[model samples]
Target: MLDLPEDKILPGTTGPALQYVLVADEAFALHKHVMRPYPNKTLDIEKRTFNYRLSRARRYVECTFGILSNKWRVLHTAILVNPDFATEIVKTTCVLHNFVRRRDGLNCNDELLTSDLPTLPNCNTSRPSNAINTRDLFKKYFMEEGKLEWQHNFI
Candidate 1:
């Protein structure tokens, strides 16, 4: 690990100093950051920012885990045959969950499509296919109406 010079520790110079030290790496900033010493207050701010970004990033990860738990019941020990099969079971379960979710017609990134972001029904959990279809249609209608209003605003 290259120790940055005293001059490099100053504000506005850290990026260049870090880049110089980690010439080939895109994540020199991260390495430099982790290495740099700071007071408790500064460290607390960094920690808070890290936590906020982590929490935001992890929502998707949590959703994936939730999908796994709900779809395959991976939390159940019945799926585990042995230690060897455990890895395969986890992978297979994720694939199966995704496959079944798609097959059941849940569209990821489908906009709420309402003025105030309408409260969507928790239909993806488990409901009749027809119920899901009906929900989709209702949502689509509102989405179209919202789009029309949005267009009118722009025009």
Candidate 2:
């Protein structure tokens, strides 16, 4: 449906550089194609392969959500009185979680992650639960598609 020509797809440069990209759009089967021939050889390879790699590295986001929802269970018993207070509570919870991890120097077992926390069934995303793979995603995607994050270089 995009009808985008091969020349118009401006590849993204932010975050991490990637290589091959394979998009399987059932809605627009014509768009279900790969984007190869990256101009920046130093950054990536082919689009299909790059997509495969990127898919894995983004798994941490889900894991973070799971930890937040399961442990807090705030999603179920939400305090829907004041929007601002609710937002503040969420932020505080996240900060406390990070502080505990840092104070422990990440040495303790990740038992807290798997503890008897409340599990929030539906967060927001429209995709089905089994649509994506979580474990080994980093291994599958990052090694090939991960670009060197720019730490100091502004240009």
Candidate 3:
């Protein structure tokens, strides 16, 4: 846990506190800012729907990285340069990738979006109640007000 100062935690925004979280896979540890899908056991409709939605978002992210790595071969290997230069390299690649995509369009044969979902070992660690509650709230929202009509079909 980070021993952040109080001011860092509460930035004094005008409106209600917004919870920003990362959509991660099973390999990541769940926390207030990281949401992972529930275990693939005893899943009810709500859980299945949540998993489907989360997986769909994760797929887009994976596909983007796939395209980037295929285009910029430098990203495939470890970047041994200074941290600042590495950041610039990544930013530049993203800009160039978008520019090229807009101009030439995707040639899937050359820039194939390959996805390899790794099998993660079972994690027995108990997550904090706050994190669990946050995920539950999202699941409830997805099942109710925030649901897309076609989301049920995917589940």
Give the CA lDDT, 0 to 100, for residue 54 in model 3: 90
Candidate 2 segments whose C-alpha is farther than 4 A from its true place: 1-45, 75-83, 111-155
Q: List the residue pairs that clash in candidate 2.
A: 19-46, 20-46, 20-47, 20-48, 20-50, 21-47, 21-48, 53-141, 56-137
**lDDT, ranked from best to worst:** 3, 2, 1
Q: What is the per-residue lDDT of model 1 for residues 1-155, given as tens digits with 9 covering 90 to 100?
A: 44445523223222322222211111112232221111126434333333333344345655556556655556434554776698688888878867876877786543221122234442223334543343233223333431234322321
**What is the per-residue lDDT of model 3 for residues 129-152, given as tens digits with 9 covering 90 to 100?**
988877887787778766889998
Residue-level lDDT of model 2, residues 24-140, one tens digit each, is 222211212332121234533333344443433334544675666655667436577688798788888788778877887877555325434344443333442223322123223
For residue 100, model 3's alpha carbon misses the true position, in angstroms, by: 1.2
Best of the two (1, 3) by lDDT = 3
Is 1 or 3 the stronger prediction by TM-score?
Answer: 3
Give each model's whole-structure lDDT.
Answer: 0.40, 0.43, 0.78
Q: Pick the candidate with the highest lDDT.
A: 3
Worst 10 residues of 3 by lDDT: 7-16
Q: Each model's number of backbone clashes?
A: 0, 9, 0
**RMSD (CA, angstroms), candidate 3:** 5.2
What 10-residue stretch in candidate 1 is worst by lDDT?
19-28
Candidate 2 residue-wise lDDT at 144: 38
